[model samples]
Structure formats: C-alpha cells, structure tokens
Target: MAYNFKNGRESVGDEPRSGRPVEARTDNNVQRVRTFEHQDRRITVRMLAYELNLKRETVRKILTDNLSMKKLYAKMVPSS
Candidate 1:
C-alpha cells in the first residue's frame, strides 16, 4: 500500500528540522571545542560560542556530552 499527497508541497525525502539547522555539531567542531577547553579550563560558554560561531547551547553540548565534561565553579572539568 502507498499513500501520497498530490499537493506540490509534498517532497520525496525528509523535511528540514524546525530549528536553525545542525551545523553546530560536527567532528571538526567537536575536536575544536575540546582543544579550546583544554587550553583554558575557565573559558566561558559565551566565549566558546563566539569563537566557534555556534550557539551557547551547542558549545555546551560539545563540552558536556562529546567531551564528557561539566562546568565546575566556572571551569570545564571532567565529569567523573
């Protein structure tokens, strides 16, 4: 069985996301974020975001999730 919409708006592939797009998260960006954090533990999220041209949340995710780190007393350190 197949169901299709005759409207011109219909597309054959997945639609774009609802947000600003997923450019912030990438292998290169992740490595860059790690390098920046390693160079300065006290680097602020705002600074990282600005340097990488990514949103604060995206930078934070790279730090916490990708790097397994967390903010501790205004510093980024290992989660464990």
Candidate 2:
C-alpha cells in the first residue's frame, strides 16, 4: 500500500492486468475427459480435475454440460 502511494497511484482499486483469460473448456480437454471417463466410469470429479490440472468446477461442467452426465449413487451416469 505504501509503495503504491509513493508511485503516485490515484485509485486503490486493482490495476488492469495483462494476459489471456483461463479457458478450461476446449475441444482437446473435452476429448481427454471423455477418454478418461471411457477408461474408468467410476472416476471422481476431483481426481479428474487433479489429473488434468483443471478446476473441479470445470471438470463438473464438462461432465454435466459437455458430456450430459449426472451423479447417481455417487457415480457418474448419463442423464436421460
């Protein structure tokens, strides 16, 4: 905070950041998830996320939205 004041920063809000936004939902990732699911139908979302180095929410989204799957009896099952 002191450094910012010395540097003549006017506002206290966060500065504009530069870099590409994180995009976990890509065709390649989706394909990889699908392949892993095929190999093991009982894999957990946390395991999948850790294995893929992606967020758990991202893995869940891929399972539900992209793959149309849902949890049943603590296992991933295809939604009707």
Candidate 3:
C-alpha cells in the first residue's frame, strides 16, 4: 500500500498547523467587531458576543486589544 499503517505512513504534505490562531481572532474578525461597536457606542461585551456570534472573552479581547476600546461607566469608549 502507498500509505503503510503497520509501522509508519508515507505521506508528504504541508506541515500541520497547531499553533495558528483561530479564525475568530483574525484581523477580519476584529474589523467586524469594530464595525458593530461603531454602530452602538454603548454595547456591552456580552451583548457584542451575542450579536457577533462569538464568545464573551473573544469579544472582550477584540474590543480591548484590537480595537483599543474599554468599558467605562457602562459605556464602550475608546481608551486613551
């Protein structure tokens, strides 16, 4: 057989990518989150997650890290 299973397999292809970031954390996703926040300046992280179909933590990361935004006094605003 071309690909042996007894001892070892013969396969030559691209290396597996286990350290790559998930699609949810890509730049495109960040931009999408930015757009949503722009529409509603007071949107909460939990609300954003629900609207964008992402996890609360992921949305928080996108908002704080990628977008440079923060929640202050129940408002999503740009952090200086």
The models' CA-based lDDT, in order, is 0.83, 0.90, 0.82
C-alpha lDDT (0 to 100) for residue 47 of candidate 3: 91
Which residue runs does candidate 3 get wrong by more than 4 Å?
Answer: 1-23
Please write out the lDDT profile of model 2 over residues 29-67, one tens digit for every residue: 899999999999889999999999889999999999999
Query: Which residue runs does candidate 1 get wrong by more than 4 Å?
Result: 1-13, 16-23
Displacement of residue 9 (Cα, Å) in model 3 is: 15
lDDT of 1 by residue, 7-79 (tens): 4546678666797665678999899998887788778989999988888999988888888887888877898
What global local distance difference test value does model 1 have?
Answer: 0.83
Who wins the lDDT comparison? 2
lDDT of 2 at 24: 81
What global local distance difference test value does model 3 have? 0.82
- Scored by TM-score, the top model is 2
TM-score of each: 0.71, 0.73, 0.68
Q: How close is candidate 2 to the true structure, as a TM-score?
A: 0.73
Model 1 poorest ten-residue lDDT run = 1-10
